[model samples]
Target: MPDAGHPAAGAAGGSVPHRPARLPLVLLRSPWFIGLTVVTLACIVAVFTGPLGRPLDVALNLVLAALDLATAANAFSTARHFPSRPVRRLALGVGLIATIYLISDLTEAVGTATGLLASQETLANVTIVGSNLVLLGLLLRYPTGARSRSDRLTFWLDAGSVLVGAGVITWCLMLGPRREGWSLEHLATALGTAVLLAMVAFAVVRLMLSKRPPLARAPTIWAVGSTFVLYASSLVHASPELLLRIGLADDLASSFLMMVALWTHRVQLRLDPDILRRRRRKPFSALPYLAMAAMFVVVVFVVPEGLGMRSISALGGLAVISLLVVLRQLLAFAGNAQLLRRLDRTLVDLRAHQHRLRALLDHAYDITLTVDPRGRMSYLSPAVERTLGVPPAALRGSRWRTPLHPQDARNLMRAVPALLAAAGTTVTWQVRARSTDGTWRWLEVVCTNLLHEPAVCGVVCNARDVTESRDLHDRLRFQAFHDPLTGLANRMLFTERLIAALTEVPEKPVSVLLLDLDGFKEINDVWGHHAGDTVLVTVASRLTAAVRDQDTVARLGGDEFGVLLVGTDRAEAERVTERLERQLEEPMALDPGPAEATVRVVAGASIGIATRDGECFPDPSPPVDAMLKAADAQMYRRKRLRRTGGGRQTGRG
Candidate 1:
């Protein structure tokens, strides 16, 4: 036989070895061949032995031998396929012992009454029993491909029970003739009783301890228990007090044991009735249980008692039980075959789905991830590898909070529970994540809790690196609020500040100073707008530098500027406006001087002060507009005073 690890000579590499075609047919695998051979041999033996008497017993012996031969051959075949050395040895040893027992039994059957009690037969039986014990031990202790701990334990118990039975037979053969009824030397009766009691006790304990709910609660246990109890009760009745003691006791014990065995068989059938039903449904392996049950029913209902029908019925019942067991096994084999096919299809579908999802994720630009309710990452798309430069696998099985920026991590942790509770709500935040290149990248993540969809099952976050966009937005917003020419507050922003100051100073005094450069138009016409703009910008900077930081300086329009003095009294506001005017009046050295124009331009301003009483400025609008108009009127009055040779009034108008 070829070893399990070795390939057949003509087979391709990595392929399993094929069984040799010339080997003897297997009873289980090639049942037709073995069945036919056994039946033909039994028929021949029965024909020669005559119709009645010992012909049936001779045929039974032949059938038993055939079964033993088949078991031995299969054991050898299985031994060659075993990968473990100890298991192989165990199988081979069992096969050898079985072969020996088969030969001895066959020899005894042929020799009939003369050779049945020979020493060779006894030795063969003992060897077979001993080898089976060794095999059972190996099966229990050693791990096999298909056997579990429970299966091993069951095998050990079964083998031990059989050994106990064989020991009883051996004792009976050795000492049955040497003593009277119920004597110690009538060992068969005593040992047989002991074996029956032991078997029932073991069965009860096994049934009670079994993890399988069906077996643990099975009625078979009670049936077997009653059988042994009945037999033991019959032994008590064997005394002279009971009439026709031996005959009645033997009859009752045998009948009760047979009935109990049959009942146990029926209970097993009920426990797994589908097994027989399924077997009948199959085309190749039909229900042997149905046939067996039919035979038992016929014998019980129709057979006459005078023709030794009781013995025939008992034999028929045994056959029925065996057939039922075999049928159930066949159904289990079919179910396993169907399950394997379904598993293969499921695996194939799973692989295909995985491949498609992988492709979609790998090609996407956005970094997508799924997080659990605890804010731990459950899944990350492949795009994370390309976008964040971090492999998806690397981020898997890690908490999302760990990857967040330190400043944001605490807030994110707190938000997780709330987000989970809200279900469909989306939360957005900016976080920093470590990239594959070991640099931190700013990620704007929008996470939506998909609690609405059972399939979604997690928080889905779609993140993108928005650093460039954020920077651009900040720059654009700054430009919108500030003057591009001078980089100072623009008209739009100055108006907003004016409104804010008026609203803020409900009881406090506030002032607005409006300044316009004197003779600025002539300077611009001669020196060009570019030179004029440079001068205006210079003046605005000086004004900004002179004022307190809280004060506002803005280029209101062409050649006009405004300042809103916060928290200032009328005196302080006058002093600040004077200081700004003086700074602007300072001579600017214009570039490209032929120095012919040689001009020193004086810049002056009009000041307006607004102090809030309880009712003077009741609304925000009037106060802000009035402040600017007052400042403008004061500036005109001052310019007229300067032209008329009147001294300039610095007081608030």
Candidate 2:
């Protein structure tokens, strides 16, 4: 939308989304228009009546003053409601100009009605000149779209040509012809009228030639029409052949046009300034050419009267006009050359930047995608195929979250609305994505909001694959708590489970069984360390098979192993011990190597059982160290009994 400070639509940050509303039709039926029309008809009737008597003339002047005063009041009141700064300033300037016109009309009326104000003609002319000067100032001070220094310079050159040519025409028409017995006052009046006409011409020309006009086309056209009428009226009033009453009628019509211009502007202010279309300007204005043609016509008419000082002056003015035109063309050519050079450099830099961006997007390990406000993928980089095993073209226009795990997709969809609500916010999240190979891969995605940016207008996502790292982390966690060789729980894991069972439910029956191979060391000495490893592997397998799936079996150290039985008492523990004993006793077949025959050997294990019982255990009732010590004592007692000829298969708890 156009900014309040600038009036030109589509200028820099001035793009609009809708067409500007037209002027209100009710203005045609407005009281100001009706009154002005009635006054115009009366002025025409009075002009055709041959003699405007003093009483009637004073009445008309007073009526015109009143009309001007009303216009000024309306302008001032409407200006207060305008939202645009430039529009408001223009409305206020119009009010001030109308107020000056009112003062001029009042001065003329007072002079006609009363003879006390002797210098009324001079005062009236001064006020009228002051008002034109104010209009000139307002036209020049109005803002235009931003332009280059060269463009502004060219505009001024063209303006200077028109102004210089108008000066020649003003001199030829108002002051060139000889006048016999002319008074100083008469000469002064003619000169003032000529200067005022030139000012009006310049104001109109400047408004038309503006690259970005402060007013819309309709209002500006009406304003230009008003000034042109004033210029024509001043010329007719200065001429000796035209009736003075006709000039007055033209003045009345010019005032009417100005009022219409103000009313149109008021209607414009009621609509959104952002939707108003500014007038487009031509590449080159023909106004200077028209001014030169007028000057030449004036010179042709004045030259045939004889070769005099005015003739020479008119020819010299034509030469100056020619020089200005040539200089303006040269400046335009130079400015074009400079613009072309700058454009070429900008194109070269843009191409180089694009090449570098393409290289980065193609080679980067991370996949980059742009998602529009509709949640569809607008762009995906070349790395998408390499990282996700999915082609970029297939995903374009599809939702980027389609391949994500169900929970992750839901979470991303929920967060997308918040991320889009604020511009430039960024979020990073990890999601599991199903690849073409039917394996779920981890992707760490960083999404940044750029919906406010005109060039981007989408959210940018950079995703990097992290599946290998995640798998390595899981393996490391498993190795921290389990034995690497036997794939069974280690001593640390067994102790942790025992402590958890004791603290979770204190009244629940829990027991630990400790076991030691009877002659495992002798087997390693006889068949090398390879045979000892084989025996340990076989014994671990049998122990795991003998217990329930919920029970935990661990390699304590060396040839010793441990088992934790939950919800079990002494009798249950003894039954498990007998099953473990039978499995270990039957596993005896072994092969030393391919070169040796198979040998049968019995690898028996001594077992001990300790149940958690507050009545049997000493001071530290259910502590982990106290329970482990009780089981160790029972295992040693059983080993001693077997060695001293007391045959015992299981130890008492």
Candidate 3:
């Protein structure tokens, strides 16, 4: 549904505007057109100055009144065609006044034609006075776009202040002057005229003081001009000579102004429906000051001529004006002080909020960073010093990748574009970064893209030092796959590596060696299990040192040990077996106590070797269990030969 108060909305709701001819609107707006119209009206008024009889004069007056009525009716009818309720109501008031004027003019014209001028003149005067009062009431009640109580109050205050100053001047110039031997009728006429003048003053003030007037500025200006001309015409009627010469001329000029106002109103309405709804508030008005200055001028001019009752009265009014000015200034000062106080409170609240936010960011365990789209750090939180061992200022405006390890930096570069592509998303990654001490530390970083947010127009990164946790995890994993006593690969990891070397690349040569410690039970009985453990530890170290770095060395339970050598053929396996024998031949030291001397013992082992090459497994890879069984059988066979004195003797097996 369209808004009923706005003409544009009504037009959208299917109301067709009555478009008037543009010729009249153009002519009315032109200065030359107005001057020509005034000249024509003056000529018409000059016709009344001729020695024309009463009937012809009455006929001319009737024609002029009819013309005025037609223009007023045209304006009212056009306003009715529009949807604006305010314009229609305003037009109704103008139409009522125009109708009363036409009726007053008709009464005098008809009475003159019928030779009943005395009674009709009184009726006309009464009607004019009533119309003036009605006009003043309308000026007070009519809406002038003041929508709030404060706005309306301010409008009236400014208007009242200006009116007071103008009233003082009007009294001094016109009303204060006393004429000799005035009759009762003359006195009554003077009082009525004074009242009418005050009414005109108020209308002019209201028109000028309203910041957002109900009508368009140009139309309202034309309307105010018409009011001034009508008021002047009413005053001229007091002089018989002026009345005979230019009385009708005043009416014609006023009608011209009214006609222009109506035409301008129509033109504006056709152009834009809500053109009159201009809202602007000025903080200051010079009207009161201007009024005060005028009052001072009046006092200066009036006091120089001698202090009479009028002078005394003017002085009193001046004092009242000065007090009003002071009171208004005080109110303005109070408003300004209240505004300043409110601004200070708002600023304090903002500062407190900022303080709390900074405190949280500083105390957090995470090192938060604000990074721009170009990957430069805009802000690094104070927590960075505690976590990264570097102050925040050292990293700000630098690239986020600056502290990252080269390999991690490359990985992060690959991931960052994908992260930024999904704007406003959060992603977590663990990367290595170099701390201030030049050691790489693991960091768990969470990044969120917030470039679209006004307050945080960047990517937010929350990085935590996770190096301790990472080290603990690595230790746990190592314990799971390694021997706790010797820090060597356990049976599980040895089997896994052997299987991988055989199955992953079946064509590669691989070798496995199994050795059982000789006379290990005798040593445990002679030196106790403590010395036995030391012997096992020394043997494990020697075996690991003898094998290639890539070979797997593991304790295969009890006093047995195993080695896995990848990419080794039978010849290389035999040479590695010889090296292991030589390493075991080196003595193992067993210290009993501080009180006892250190004893030397030799730890020897019966060794077995199994090799897999293209010749051993021509097509399919050898099974892991098969390789272990082969190595074990060979080791047992060598032990039996050593016991039977059939194997080569290096040391006691």
lDDT of each: 0.57, 0.76, 0.73
Clashes of each: 0, 0, 0
lDDT of 3: 0.73
lDDT, candidate 2, equals 0.76
TM-score of each: 0.46, 0.61, 0.49
Best by TM-score: 2
Q: RMSD to native for every prediction?
A: 23.4, 9.6, 14.2
Clashing pairs in 3: none
Global fold similarity of model 3 (TM-score): 0.49
Residue 318 miss distance in model 3 (angstroms): 2.9
* C-alpha RMSD of candidate 3: 14.2
Ordered by TM-score, highest first, the candidates read 2, 3, 1
lDDT of model 2 at residue 522? Answer: 92
Can you write out model 3's per-residue Cα lDDT over 446-486, one digit (the tens) per residue? 98877667787677888898999999999998998888888
Candidate 1 residue pairs that clash: none
